[model samples]
Target: MSKQQMIPFQTTLFVKDTCLCLHAQRAARALARLFDEALKPHGLTNGQFSLMMSLNRPVPAGMADVAHLLAMDRTTLTAALKPLERRGLVIVAADEKDKRRKVLRLTPAGEVLLAAALPAWRETHATLDQRLPDIERLRADLRALS
Candidate 1:
């Protein structure tokens, strides 16, 4: 088979400049870092805060539903829950209505912690929204991609 031509640095630069996924990923990491830092005093990272928030509900949420909402697989969701469980912030149990399905619930401590983290999350989120004009449009576009 003929050898493929080597790609040039200019093409790589063009890809970096124009790729939607690359830009989205970079923005996501940056935003996560900013929120993570903002949440440090509360002893939570952005991901943990999101995971906890996802479980906020009157009824415990099912594992598959949580995983789908988080855009993560079941295995990854399990790993993420480990630390929160250890901290007594989250409790996963068999769904009362359906014994086979595992349900996610925030413990009393988790509710308290999430309550405390809300102000921090709100502040950081507002800053992000202010920094990025047309944030609502951007979110809609991003959701379209998903």
Candidate 2:
């Protein structure tokens, strides 16, 4: 493209400064990094922590329910569960009542890990909440957007 026909560099600056999607993505990445670091000692990523947490319930959760709650597709959720399943931290099995459906539950080992990881997660969130001007509103806005 000729120099005269090229998009202006100022347009790039405008997007960097004002794009909501860009800002949200950057913030999400930053938050993920922080949680990843906090959960690192437990051999968990933020995504894994979230996935496991979604299965914490009185009954084994259906794969579809867990997938929806985690904002992931069933394929993605299934892939994410493999390492945890291999480690015996989680169990994925066919529902006895519905042979075609899969359900997920945390094993005793998973519960123990989650219990241990809770304090670290709590502490990190507390420190982060103190820094944010309005965490509740930010969360609500994010939920609405999602």
Candidate 3:
């Protein structure tokens, strides 16, 4: 084929020189879609599931701490929490010690929803593991990047 004809019609550029970011983003999006479908019955999106899981571990986490752990900016995290708050799945309250700070906690309803979603999550995770046996390696690589 001539050089002009061989060239692709369109080329997409990622934000950076590294493919790692793009690959991770694409993988996360795909996984989120799959988990979203699986968690639909429990009325939880993958993001909500993750947030609940994070809050389930401890009693009331400061918003900043939770945001840091989730690697999300405060604004973005606040936006994500709105739906959960509306659904009564989570509660956000001002920290008593510091009125300016907010704390996040999973409500009883959130716990129940998380419990209902766990089986679906496990099945999806297992399927992914079966498909990507090298996931551990990928995880290690990703950790190294971090």
Please give the clash total of every predicted structure, in order.
0, 0, 0
Q: RMSD to the native, candidate 1? A: 1.3
Could you tell me every candidate's TM-score relative to the true structure? 0.94, 0.95, 0.83
- Give me the runs in candidate 3 sitting further than 4 Å from their true place: 1-18
Checking candidate 1 for backbone clashes, the offending pairs are none
Tens digits of per-residue lDDT, candidate 1, 23-137, equal 9999899989999999999999999999999999898899999999999999999999999999999999997888999999999999999999999999988988999889999
Q: What is the per-residue lDDT of model 2 for residues 1-146, given as tens digits with 9 covering 90 to 100? A: 66677778999999999999999999999999999999999999999999989999999999999988988999999999999999999999999999999999999999999999989899999999999999999999999998
Candidate 2 has its poorest 10 consecutive residues by lDDT at 1-10
TM-score of 3: 0.83
Q: Could you give me the TM-score of model 2 versus the true structure?
A: 0.95
C-alpha lDDT score of every prediction, in listed order? 0.95, 0.95, 0.87
Per-model C-alpha RMSD? 1.3, 1.6, 5.0
lDDT of 2: 0.95
lDDT of 3 by residue, 35-76 (tens): 999999988889889988989865699888889888899999
